[model samples]
Target: MTDATLDRIAGALAGMVLGDALGVPGELWPREKVRSRFGRIEEFLDGPADNIVACYFKAGHYTDDSAQAFVVLEALLKAGTVPPAKTLADDLLEWVRSMNGFEINLLGPSSKASLLAWSKGEDAEAVTKLSLTNGAAMRIAPVGCLVEANEHEKLAETVARVSRVTHSTDVAISGAAMVAQAVASAVAGRSWDEIRTDIAAIHPIALVKGEPTWAASVLARLEAFEAMVEKLGDAPSEEDVSLLIYRAIGTGTMTSESVAAALAVALWCRDPWLAAVMCANMGGDTDTMGAMACAICGAKCGISGMDESVVKYLETTNGIDFRALAKRILEARANFTIGD
Candidate 1:
């Protein structure tokens, strides 16, 4: 990989960590509670808070989002690309089965469901029918990076293969595909407008078409997503911008509303720091949103786009050196040919 490519990967990885850490503190707070408690979320504050991170004195510790992302990264490294559905399912199940000690912290709800089914001797294809959670989208960002510059078909297939092992709902698969495609576009240096437009075109069938249930809500909220994207155009104040989007959109549910809210934070930020902080503070499902936002901004700006404070905090708290992880992934990529 070229130095620039490595730098971009590093930035994105760091952005993921930064976002995970930032969002950890406000994971389940309602919008009003978040606003009342934090008074407009900006920067990592040390104190009691509803989010998991506040339980620790340090900053930057990651939750299931970043940890599962690393699992996806590991799978990509070993498989040499996005594996096919059966292969992906087997690999993920094997990984989960091998978990011992500290590795237990990484599995999520959808993954847990799949693992339990597998343990009970269920078929992989049949097991996936049990879940409809955000677990698929949460870990699939690495697929975006792994298949950089690929078209929507390739991206969608990769996401679907990985997702169907656990998250088979159209909403989960579509959300994963959208995130992967968006990250891939960003990595290819596409403009944000282009990324959004491309995502809209890629998933026309999956966009909301009916009442606002979890499955249909992401599509139903398109107008609100577009509005937030528009508001982010002027480079508004980070605090004001985050609140505006949070109030206008919201960060609840596993649907598109949450994804759009996270994307709004990334789109509005002048840098990865602001993106991570803003997404983290939106409360419910904060870590997942933060991680997704980090992936988007990090792909666009590279590691230099992040704040030193954020990087330091993540390393100290999470015991994960995101920059090193990026370098390792780049090295792995260099050793394999495109079709290998």
Candidate 2:
């Protein structure tokens, strides 16, 4: 692997963990409530008691978004490419059990249902998947890392195959596909100006690989993001910019909304730390958006864009060695080809 890619991969992992931990304190908060409570979350804070989801964890701890992303990364390292659906499912089930996800209610609606069905002996492909959540997109950055963006067919196939265990709907797959492509493109040193167009084009291409659905399209949401960015003009206040994305593109857990919001944040606020704080305060699905957005930002700029103290704390808290993980991923990726 190239030295530059190795650095970006480390940054992507750190950025992902950092964003997740930062957002945990106010997951699902209203923008106003977030502003009223914390002003601007420059550092990690414990989840407020009233936040049912965030309340389960303490300061600087990544939530299920990054956890599941690690699951996918582990699978990729083991498989040296795309693992089978059952392999990924089995690993995810282990994560749910080991993390006490059921008792803690850490699983998303789609993932929980699919995991429960799979645990109950339902075939992976047979699990009912009507929900169109960002569960897949949240954990899909590893696919981006392992597969280059030029191989969109392979990328789409791997994304669909792995995501089948949880979210297999068209909308869900479309969102996941775009994120994976974006991260891959960013890691490859492509500018967001170009990656934005790549992801928008990738939406329809990957959409066809999953079960047809009537949900809001990720493409439409991304298109909406363009107008929101344009309206921000040369210099909008942070409050105004945050509200624009919250109100226009949204920041919810839906595959369409959060996925697009993450892309917008990655484009609008290219700094990894800034993106994390912005997502944390933006409300809705803060952690997932932070994870996604920061993954892209970190991929583009590497760990150089992150605060050294924050990255160090994230590594120690999570027992994560981003450099080591990047090396392992590079080794695994070396074994993969678009044909595989």
For model 2, how does the per-residue alpha-carbon lDDT over 206-273 read when each residue is reduced to its tens digit? 89978888888888877776776677788887678788889988888888889988888888888889
- Which candidate number maximizes lDDT? 2
After TM-score superposition, the amount by which residue 215's alpha carbon in candidate 2 deviates from its true location, in angstroms, is: 1.4
Q: lDDT tens digits, residues 237-329, model 1? A: 656666676676767656455666666666656367767767766667777888887887888787766667767766776677766777777
Best by TM-score: 2
Superposed Cα deviation of residue 185, candidate 1 (Å): 1.7
Off by over 4 Å in 1: 40-58, 83-109, 123-127, 204-214, 217-220, 228-244, 331-340
